[model samples]
Target chain A: MKNFGGHVLFLDRADINTDEIIPAKYLTEIAREALQPYLLESLTLDGFDPKRDIPGKQVVISRANFGCGSSREHAPWALEVNGIRLVIAESFARIFRQNMFNCGLLVVELPCDTIARLFTDYARGETFATADVARGVIQIRTGTKAEEISFRLSDFDRQLVEAGGWLEYADARY
Target chain B: MGQTVAEKIFETHVVDRPAEDVWVIRLDAVLCHEITTPTAILDLMRLGKDRVFDPSRIKAVIDHVTPAKDSNTATQGKVLREWARRHHITDFFDIGRNGVCHALFPEKGFIRPGYAVIMGDSHTCTDGAFGAFTPGVGTTDLAVGILKGVCAFRRPQTMKITLTGELPQGVFAKDVILSVIGRIGVDGATNRIVEFDGPVVQRMNMEARMTLCNMTVEAGGTCGICYADAITADYLWEHIRGEYPDKAAAAADFRKWWPDPDAVYEKTIVHDVSGLEPVTTFGQKPDNVRPVREMEGTPIDQVFIGSCTNGRMDDLRSAARVLAGRKVHPHVRGIVCPATTKIFSEALEEGLIRVFTDAGFCVTNPTCGPCLGMSTGVLAEGEVCASTSNRNFNDRMGRGGRVHLMSPATAAASAIAGHITNSELYKA
Candidate 1:
């Protein structure tokens, strides 16, 4: 059973694209660590500031269609380098969702109403979550409130996370 | 239990069932480009798994930041060049020959009906116009496709988009796709394969079909597919002639990839383009669409007419038609990049290049630059561009730059007007 989740960063907008995750200009760089400081650098959510908002957050809560536009693994690499491992959203672009799993990060797709509730209940507070892969539930808490939310990962996705990433899985199988 | 074209292709390519509803499918082609492939190549080397599964099945190109914007970009191109050579991949297209990968690969006739293709760039879905199961992947899956020739996916449900009625005189495939995206919203088709069908799609040539499928990703579609028809056969006849006796035979053979009449779709939507007008993106997202009429007179600093989406010969000809005698507005800078070296040569011979140059548009060699803001015509802060390329995401063209997506004709017209405007006013 692997552990997931941490401090939550709530991005309230939909269609948070790859360009926003890691701008196309930085994509010329070869190293993954080179992407660390630039995570969400171009995101233009109402009051979000990458320099102020991304430092210690280890999880992302966002609206629908997160990670849309341009299929770049650098998007996930940016998140990973920033020490974020879990993303909870109403939905995600197809390639971005798979890329997250390939990198051993988790993208939890909650229903629209559920995500709205999560934002209403926790977004303004200092939120933290503890995700249990084995039990398929996430324990979300703030200073004075706590809630349990369940998530399901496909068997292959769970295997990828347990193996650490696609590279490790390929090492064993291929 | 009839199957869609995507389902049939997946069935044919399946190598294993990794999990329930998850099938590991063998890839027929793995498309690679400088911007994304270098990281995959480096990772494979670090893991001591640098060998490709099949050298011949790989197609490599140096399209993004071509001629290299700086040493870092030069290194990225060099990495892909050396990797292709080391793997004995003969289909590598270097600086003088390279173009945008999505346009270049299909131009070489590498894609065919029923093929399963993957690339590291999102616009790779443009290849699905050939009636293939082509989808974009990330670097990790790209590395796996390169190394083992296999990638996994959950079975994608199909969403059928039936395009009815006729395309209006000034409305092109770019407008049609933009309209579709607007109707569906950005994530309307998430995790689904969109199968484009009906009379309008049937009438479109391969270039138009590619434009329709190219932006499917903007609507969150994994792949946008079209059924192979006589037009597809005619376009592919040069490369596929050896397999079939004649164009008719080739068309018939390719038709095997079409979905069965009883095939099920998760949902169906229809669009009638009889009164369709030129459209453009108003905001950062691709789905933030508006008719060119409403967005007209919105000032623009640049007009870019290129990218895999609309950089074909027809696109250039359309743009040239608008710019034939009119000079670009003094306040605006215009750039035109043909999609491929072949298209560039043809456009030169057709005098389209002269038309563009006469109009004060900087005619450049084929590169995906400026489309993603790497080079060629990057925008400065507070700048707005009327662009023919897809994806209007904020800062996509440059930091603090705004990109409004439209057709090449509209882009050219905007260059003349110095604002976001329709091409109808310029049409002969």
Candidate 2:
């Protein structure tokens, strides 16, 4: 997968579960493409409508336990289809993290302090950023001091995440 | 190091993989329902797979949108029915024969100890109560399993929860599990295999153990396991394999796979619930729970005592005992849905259905109604329901539908009181 970075959409909320990401009603739409417009519709963040606001943002940053409830793969599919390539959160729920990797989305978990700073920088009009998965750092574009925030990924996960997803990795291996 | 039951199961099933490494494991049983099977079928067809690898090992049930609420759900159900029939799947349960997938699968002897079970629904973890490692999967992975008979899984860390002390007379296993959720936050056990043990679990019946394991998904746990014992063997012989002596004899092998005495757990927790009260959820999350007595007089619009979680015969009996001589409140609507046709027939023979019917409850056929907001009893806007199902998330039942999760006894008592009340205050 190609490394990507752009203006990040900051949803300053804690414990945002999968229910907020994709509501139960929309799960009836079996196709992944049909569920895209309804992504995060239930999440009422200020100045952000997921259907309208997601086109320009390449990354989504959220608080701890970002995808917390329900093992619905549609949650990640909705985000991926709606043009979210990477997600940086303080932490992630296990199933959603797995779903993201399975559906070809890059998810990174950074320390809480650095995540808080990213949100603060966004508020202060520091919009541009770069996520270099190969370099293991997220660099700020417009900062007084050059900010290079490092993230963690195990060798096994790096190989899978860098290769697009689990299914592709599995296909390549077999 | 010694391993928990889940670790042991993975050790045996996962091919050439260490702990925490992804390994493709052969799935003993794969279940898909109407709402999910359609997509999985499409994916399978997209992969140019015309037939299921093992039709006998796959179970396709239509329980989510039974009787077809609308044309879309009807089409989906039809697609699944046609696919199952065309593929000659051995265990396909249609609407009349189907119930909630989690409850009916085990009752029909589809689940057994020491097996790797997977289903499209998130509550598939309910089968973990049978000492099997069951995890919920999405349609893609489910489709892959249907074609290949295997799915990739990483060995999860294990947690041991020891339930100490005997349950009080009025308390139930639902109360015990709700209390545990209150201790651990909603996402506290995410991706961890929660192994239930100790004195209380040993004494609980299969139904009670299922109740304990049913809500593990609410804690974001991968699976919840209780090692097979004499009770499990007796359950299989008497309940599951009735009139089939050979299956009962074969089921005796389940007892050999209990956790090692010194099993190494990532975390071990002990909960003492000897004097626990009947618990219920107050807010949106299931873990947002309180004692039913503490939340009395909290207004409710409906009471639903059915789902895979607490819709078994024992759950029905508990509700029946509470609503025997009582009438449902005028303002509240009460619904009693058995988990399966077998449960419905048993409740009918035992006069539990009569008790519910006499109390103004609308006893219905086996369907997962109002739980996922499909149909049959969908709540209206601003409606508050006291339900025995697992979740209480926002808009779970209907648009702006509020749910208070509770045990069957608490739900029955609340139906009578027109509020969230416990069975302890009810008089026979």
The window of 10 residues in a row where model 1 chain B has the poorest summed lDDT is B95-104
For model 2, residues B1-428, the per-residue Cα lDDT tens digits are: 77678777877887544124776788899898887678768766775665687989999888877777777788888888898889888699887788889889988878888989888777888888889999887766676677767777776788989999989877998899888988897877887889999999999999999999988878878878988876777767645455446654645667656787888888999999877888888877778989887888999999999998999999999999999989999999999999998999999999999999999999988988678777777889899999999888777788788998889998999999999987977857
The DockQ of predicted model 2 stands at 0.46
Give the per-residue lDDT digits (tens) of candidate 1, residues B1-428.
Answer: 99999999999999888788898899999999998899999999998889999999999999999989899999998999999889899999998888888889999999999999999998888899999999999999999999999888899799999999989888999999999999999988889899999999999999999999999999989889999989999999899989989999998898889999999999999889998999999888888998999998999999999999999999999999999989999999999999999999999999999999999999999999989998999999999999999988889999999999999989999999999888889987
Q: Using Cα atoms with residue i matched to residue i, what is each candidate's TM-score against the true structure?
A: 0.99, 0.94
User: Which stretches of model 2 miss by more than 4 angstroms?
Assistant: A2-4, A44-52, A123-130, A140-146, A162-164, A171-174, B16-20, B238-252
For every candidate, give the share of true A-B contacts it also has.
0.88, 0.32
DockQ of each: 0.84, 0.46
The best candidate by TM-score is 1
* Prediction 1 TM-score vs. true: 0.99
